[model samples]
Target: MHDSKNALSVQKLIADLAGIVRIMDQKDQQLAPAINAPSQSWLETWMTAFWETLCREWASIDQWRMNKVLLLVRFFIREQFGLALEWAVKQDPKLKDQVARQLRVLEAWPLSPRERRVPDGLRLHVLDVWTEELAGQLSAAQKALDEDAENSDPESKKSILLSLAQEFMEPVRKISREAISKGVKIRAKEAVKLAEEQLSG
Candidate 1:
């Protein structure tokens, strides 16, 4: 999407190009097989069409809309893929690990219009790995924390848990600070220092 001066439907044009991008990226595995070897499988074609739509929509949306788009993408992946998700995640633990990395990028929350070039292509790369898969990992982490809590003294637990929470929370605090306009960055200075101290300690 662009300013008023831009001609034609930028949304449609972007979507069209993004459809091609999605197909091209998946050509080797998902798209090529259907084209080269003519599968009568309704399932395969349906899946491809779904992916095409997702990619096209993702490319053409603003940041706020993009959040909704990603949620829909996750929901569709889970719904379209049921028991298969377990097999997929089981087969590729590394892919599950990558989702956290992708989520971190999303959480940083790019400022739309300005940071328009954010590559959600990476998100698509690992989309087959579902939220349950990622959430399960987080649950596992928290479970470990719970187990640790039983063993740790109150002071030790406070230190460890506070340390962990600080680790997770500091990035967002940093971003919220950074999100302030250029003139307001000075205000972020103390928050930035706090994050550094928390991180370093």
Candidate 2:
């Protein structure tokens, strides 16, 4: 038996499972093959356990597992497979609220399911409503870079922020490419550049 304390590290597993589950949840249903794939049996076993764990967690109606919930939202929006998400939501009515609106946005405007197989670093062609959230995160990172007056010098702090920003910029690039193809305006072109500098400098 798995250790009670370490049996699954359900919390960590939830976070790690984010990438795999998003493929299962995306409405693209065709992408199911990508996420459903695993070289190891442990993956299938873990996901099945996660499914059951989701039920256990649902009984308590807790939001502590929200990271996994967010990942599930990604799967529903981007993955080709819809069954895993549908099954999960059907199993737990509570999961509906966290992901339903996002799923609606995806269904409202979807791109090629095959594109989902591309790494998130390369495949995020466009973000629907989620851009606002991404912007907020980048903005917060910028503010931290600008406002660390109390803790560190601006240049040093900026170096940290720049590194953070650069890491974020790659996704922005993909989003911009995707959005441009779809004819949506980008909100943070400058922020993307700033992050690039951070990443390189």
Q: Tell me each candidate's TM-score.
A: 0.28, 0.27
lDDT per prediction? 0.40, 0.40
What would the per-residue lDDT of candidate 1 be over residues 1-201, giving only the tens digit for each residue? 545454345456445544543443344245434585533333334455655555456657675455445554554443332222222323344333323333344343321112333344523222233324333333443455456645444344334333443434344344445443442233334444444553331
- Quality of model 2 by C-alpha lDDT: 0.40
In Å, residue 86's CA in model 1 sits off its true spot by 9.9
- Colliding residue pairs in candidate 1: none
Which regions of candidate 1 deviate over 4 angstroms? 1-38, 83-131, 134-201
